[model samples]
Target: MERTRNSWKCPIFGDLNDLKDNVLPTYGDVMRFYEWTRHRLKYERERNKEPTYKEIEAIVVARLIEIWAKSSIPTVEPKRMKVMLQTYHLKCKNLLKSNPRIPKNTLEGFRLGSKALFDIAACKCQEFLKCACPKNKKIPARERGFITDQRTARQMVIGALDVVTTTKITKTLKRKSIRENSKSKRLKKPKHVRKS
Candidate 1:
């Protein structure tokens, strides 16, 4: 029998599906998802505290279920996942552009495939566990923070790929935005306390 090849080359969301189904998540799975948390939340890494093991484990079990659920798709090929992500990215970008008031900074991460994967991972983890997640019990402060961070990071990454430049982003429009922000900060001070 010809053994099937693995599609772990998808970078952010590997199609491992290696974890056992209907079983508790393992240490390795927790660690892997934690690393993905880092990948998706790169921008907020500075202020956000590192996630605890229980926090990751809480989400990892659903991830295992999500992965295993897809195991029957019969589609296991490298770069295939990447293409699917790109297609979805384009569709989302168009919808987001309906309003011009939104800032472009959030779009930066969307250009990277990692952002989509990060987003999908977050969604899949929660989606697969809708039935299992407690309906009445209130979530702890820490896990709530984790959920918020995931959404914030995904929003930051949802942007147009066309805007992506070949060079590293050194804040072209960001400089103007910073200046505007600094000016606004000064406006908040009472006139009596304002420094000429």
Candidate 2:
């Protein structure tokens, strides 16, 4: 009798319910929700191309820079923020590779867009700082929270944008070169076939 109840409780009415009602709700749910949102945004970008992955990545980096720039020291600490942004950028590249509508050249365009956006932001910041540190001035507090100095925050935002843009351009160019090499090899193969 006890064994029957224990068996039923072991999974159906027992520990599983407690976990489902409690632990799972606290941890896995939130993490999965975030992942789902990320994937959703990725797919939306893939479909519309309005917000390219590079743009998204640059925006995030810009936010990071803005947060750090506001600090008295004006540096991105904790290091992990940089790592996560790079990881997300890589994921975007992989997603773009699988997307048929995202042209090879568009990848390059995104790279350029990121750099241009960063440059614009940085230039604006610098202009504001002609008296001193303008880079720290333009950071919108809504993006980076209320913790750091505005000028430092703005600089950090540009730095983060630069990092993502540079990494993406390098990766895309490497892929483009490989494709070109493959094309050249195919041309050479046709010549050899004619000789044979």
Candidate 3:
């Protein structure tokens, strides 16, 4: 009995037969890819009890290659993975730096930053995917949740920052009160020395 080789089927590119043979993938393809990966990651976390950093990286790289191969674009090389990942990280870092409301020190800030990083990663991935096939297209309205979620996360981070700032201000005010009370006592007028 001959063993049949199983062809890898990409959730995003498996059914894009209508696309021109030479045409690159559109924004729709990238968005579908992102959603697929997000679901796969969630499933992996639930089933395998959370993958380590290295495991996660391997999964992302593998998925990227699979998507590229399935797209039938001859120009996109596997070597581009490293560059794409680096660009993604750079974009995330720049986003974090540009937004001053996301606190870097608090737990809430860290959570918000992580969300922002994921949001930027999705954006960068889409950008790279679009470049691979060079097409002018707008993301569909139904798939615009990425933008909305990022905006909501930013607002939440701003709210968290306000809370942090208020607490810090209150602490400083308490310290100042103590110091001011001591200074006031020291500056009190000396008892009147009556000339007896």
The per-model lDDT (C-alpha) reads 0.40, 0.39, 0.41
Candidate 1 CA-lDDT value: 0.40
- Residues 146-185, candidate 1: write the lDDT tens digits: 3444344523221223234412234655777899999999
Query: Which regions of candidate 1 deviate over 4 angstroms?
Result: 1-40, 47-73, 100-196
Candidate 2: segments with Cα more than 4 A from true spot: 1-47, 76-83, 88-196
lDDT of 3 by residue, 150-181 (tens): 33542311111246755875899899999999
User: Where does the lowest 10-residue lDDT sum fall in candidate 1?
Assistant: 1-10
Candidate 3 stretches greater than 4 Å from native: 1-53, 101-196
In TM-score terms, candidate 3 sits at 0.27
lDDT of 1 at 125: 36
Which one wins by TM-score: 1 or 3? Answer: 3
Q: Which lDDT tens digits does candidate 2 get at residues 1-196?
A: 0122123221101221111111112222222222333444545556543445455445444544543343322343324444655554464446455666757776565443332211212223333324243445444334333222222332322222456755875899899999999999988884434554
Model 3's lDDT to the true fold?
0.41
Q: Is candidate 2 or candidate 3 better by TM-score?
A: 3
RMSD of each: 22.1, 23.0, 23.2
Which residue pairs does candidate 1 place in steric collision?
Answer: 107-159, 110-157
Q: Give TM-scores for every candidate, taking all chains together and pairing residue i with residue i.
A: 0.22, 0.21, 0.27
